[model samples]
Target: MTSQTDGTAPAEEFMDKVFGDYVGANAIFMAAIGDRLGLFKDLAAAGPATSVELAERTRLAERYLREWLDGMAAAGYLTFDANGGRYAMPADHVPVLAEESGTMFMGAAFFDYSTKFGESFHALLEAFRSGEGVRQELYGQEAAEAIERFTAPWFEHQLVPVWLPLMPEVRTTLEVGARVCDVGCGQGRALIKLAQAFPHCELVGLDRYEPAIQAATENARQAGVGDRVRFEMHDGAAGLPGPFDVITTFDVLHDSADPAGLLRAIHDGLKPSGRYVCVDINCADRSQDNVGPMGTVLYGLSLAYCLPVSLARGGAGLGTCGLPEGRLRAMALEAGFAEVRRLPVDDPFNNVYELSL
Candidate 1:
């Protein structure tokens, strides 16, 4: 009897883990299908629909569609009614998936990753074998640029509010007209934001992708900060061009293939005792505050997608997991930053660390 119970427990545990993976894998496909097929849109318009109704309206096979709906229901993504014979997205959740504040929009990136899941796994296998993954296109320069563009708003919206209070500190160092280098400045969002807020400051956005630099330049122009904010292509891995008064990176360090080298370059690029501010995923539960859903999602992507992409690209990319302020401070010391601190960000959903060269 003990043997029977013991065997069953292990089997159940294994099955549970497998089930979790299966659901997560299939959810990625379903979410992508919903976006591409407009299935979710149809449901939104009709208010609620049975699988049969959805299939007929969508011109999909009812049986097959029902299976997908069943999975969605079981996974808490779909709500079912027995008396009414309908399935629907929970009313409260619909807005989140459909609206600007939704995790679903940001989650769209995961589908792209899911489509190339096998390649990542294979590259991971190779990495484990040789401390390296095969040369691959999964997270190359172009892909990184695209990811930055797609995720920038999602990232900025969450973190900017956190950084607002620190503006005083930022302004103190920049002296209202000092130059600031936004290294790894994807699309120049930070520069645009800063320039808009502090019209007198000079912001230079440096990135590796020409297209991204162009986009950032255009965006800065659009934001009416063109004269103050400029975007240029820089080999982010090599360093920044400076003597600038301040330098900042928004979630850039983790993506570098050689973070130590990049840090050293930035150190050399800055003016003496230049100020630095960085915002990234809190890899450590330092806050002891459980990260909200969006933060959690970014953290997961950093692990399952970001790090692997780095390894795949033959770089030493890794997510910071919002590690403790002290851990970041330690790295800054190693990187030759003079003073380091972890500051509570003014942004509603982001965290910040401040350092000096």
Candidate 2:
């Protein structure tokens, strides 16, 4: 191969990288299919089975199951026994693929990319050409549900026990029956978890998305926290229903149409002694500093969803990696916050910031 740009065979190296990405993409699509069909869960539960046996168990077509099982085995997502003519999901893979409540579960990511991002590809391409953006509503309920599924495990397992304890003062406030609101509260998982943990606290969840609000309300009811928690469709950029003891925004600000306005609203909404907990993508202000797997995922998501969604509404377009600690601190200070501290919570994909008046 002819060398281009660099002395070493650049074309060959680049093509190798491209092929690797292609294989990864195919694996993701396959994973999405398996997740949608409950193939992984069945395989994990039923143990090794021939395609026919698996088909009988899942009530799916044998021919399709055979192809899918072969693909999964090829991708190393499942083990294949040639002599036995059987396939099985590994024990360790069960937590990631089959168990929704497991902390390491990642089944929803496939749906998020294949269903949500794939559906919006043409719109995103148009936005790229016109320097405009795709609207959030265009992604539909699939995106909302995928996001809920992706974040629910974290909220269920970590929010009350792991994350909240980092902010002892806020925990104490909740314990004392403080009024709290979670902005951009998709499906009300966080607030529902909080309600279950701190029974005395009054919790409310707000999101601009109608589908998400509806889901949140239903989910709260299903969790039996309907009376303790309320879900409302409210845009924080316009204002917040306040005098709150504590407020939270999880993975929200970067996708805001008016982040600064929202920050101001949060500041004004809080009581004098209130605290604001801001959870956003873990990122650095400078582009050069962001060079890793998480950074790649965040930046890709920014292009596919976050940036465009915000820009569609005449927003600052602070894509996924835009909000680092320094940027948030400055914005919070300008929005009248007296203190903005990055909490020492150790999370790979998110940063926790505590803002106080």
Q: Pick the candidate with the highest TM-score.
A: 2
Q: Can you write out model 1's per-residue Cα lDDT over 1-357, one digit (the tens) per residue? A: 336556687887789888977778787777656644666667776778888889889999898778877777776777889898898977776654444324445334555444434545666677667765444355455444435544555445643454545656666665457788888887777788777666668889887657678888888888888988888877655767787777888777776667767777777887785677776555445544546655666666665555664665577665545334555666678988888766764443345777775
- The CA lDDT of each predicted structure is 0.67, 0.88
TM-score of each: 0.73, 0.96
lDDT tens digits by residue: candidate 2, 281-307: 888889998987777888887897889
The RMSD of every model to the true structure, in order and in angstroms, is: 5.0, 1.9
Off by over 4 Å in 1: 1-6, 36-71, 80-87, 101-121, 134-136, 140-146, 153-156, 171-175, 221-227, 285-305, 308-327, 345-351
Model 1, global lDDT: 0.67
Supply the TM-score for candidate 1: 0.73
Least lDDT summed over 10 consecutive residues: which range in candidate 2? 109-118
RMSD of candidate 2 to the true fold?
1.9
lDDT of 1 at 166: 63
